[model samples]
Target: METSKVIVEHIFLLVIVTLFSVLQNAFFAVKLEREGKGGNATAFERVSCAVRNCMDAYPTFLAVMWCAGLCVSQGPAAFAGILYLVVRQKYFVGYMGQTSQSTPGFMFGKRPIFFLILMCMVGILNYLLGHFYGRCYKAQLETLTSVVAALLLIP
Candidate 1:
């Protein structure tokens, strides 16, 4: 439940996601070679595109996740990060199968990103109110975050 532990989990998740992307690319490359499809575009284009899309969104996901983790709360941030990673993988796999199938994964995965961004906004608001007017909402926000996290089974 400690912040450090949550952050470590986030770091681990980041490593796993990165590794998945890299390994996926390598696998696709090998598959292409084995199929005698060197150079020019091939069926592997779908797989490559899936991987590229996932990597492209990685930076935004990382930023919002860490901002929420450090500024708002770690538990919820960790939960969101895990959800995002899982959905991202789902998106990749689904896309490789069929582009339209990826839509569900994309829709589900964005919730976590949005949640983190909202948390960041709340965190900033909390800080601003407390710093500028001695009306700190830390306790209130923590209670609310915990309640929401509990409802979502965040742990």
Candidate 2:
């Protein structure tokens, strides 16, 4: 199992993906901040909405997916689901934190980068653990995830 790239990738997502999403999600909380003179909600309300819209991930889905992948076989799909979610969280955080000039650079650059990395990680990992076993499938996603992850960790 130590040599399983699938395991390694899953662990990476479990730690970095989840941590980044939660922190970014917390930082990402949206708020209206305007009192209801007629039609307005507070920041708390917006945040609560976002929280509700979240992909319902937690100890169960994520853990179960990984467990199923290893223990049963249908786990990778769960893991993929979780991966998609965490990636979405990152997108939400980035979207809510962008500026003007940084729009293209943000959208064309960071957004794509984030999408590619997280997406590839989820896809490749799922494929590996699910069917391929180790046939090698371009691995661009792994490269992106690892590189971006390293960059994010940098000061």
Which model scores highest in TM-score? Answer: 1
TM-score per candidate, chains pooled: 0.72, 0.32
lDDT of 2: 0.44
TM-score of 2: 0.32
C-alpha lDDT of residue 52 in model 2 = 47
Clashes of each: 0, 3
* Regions more than 4 Å wrong, model 1: 1-42, 150-155
lDDT of each: 0.72, 0.44
CA shift of 131, model 2, Å:
21
For residues 1-155, write the lDDT of model 1, one tens digit per residue.
69988667656644554455457557645654644454545447776777668878878887787677666677677677777777877887788778999998898887888888888899999889889999888767767776675443332
Best by lDDT: 1
- lDDT for 20 in candidate 2 is 56
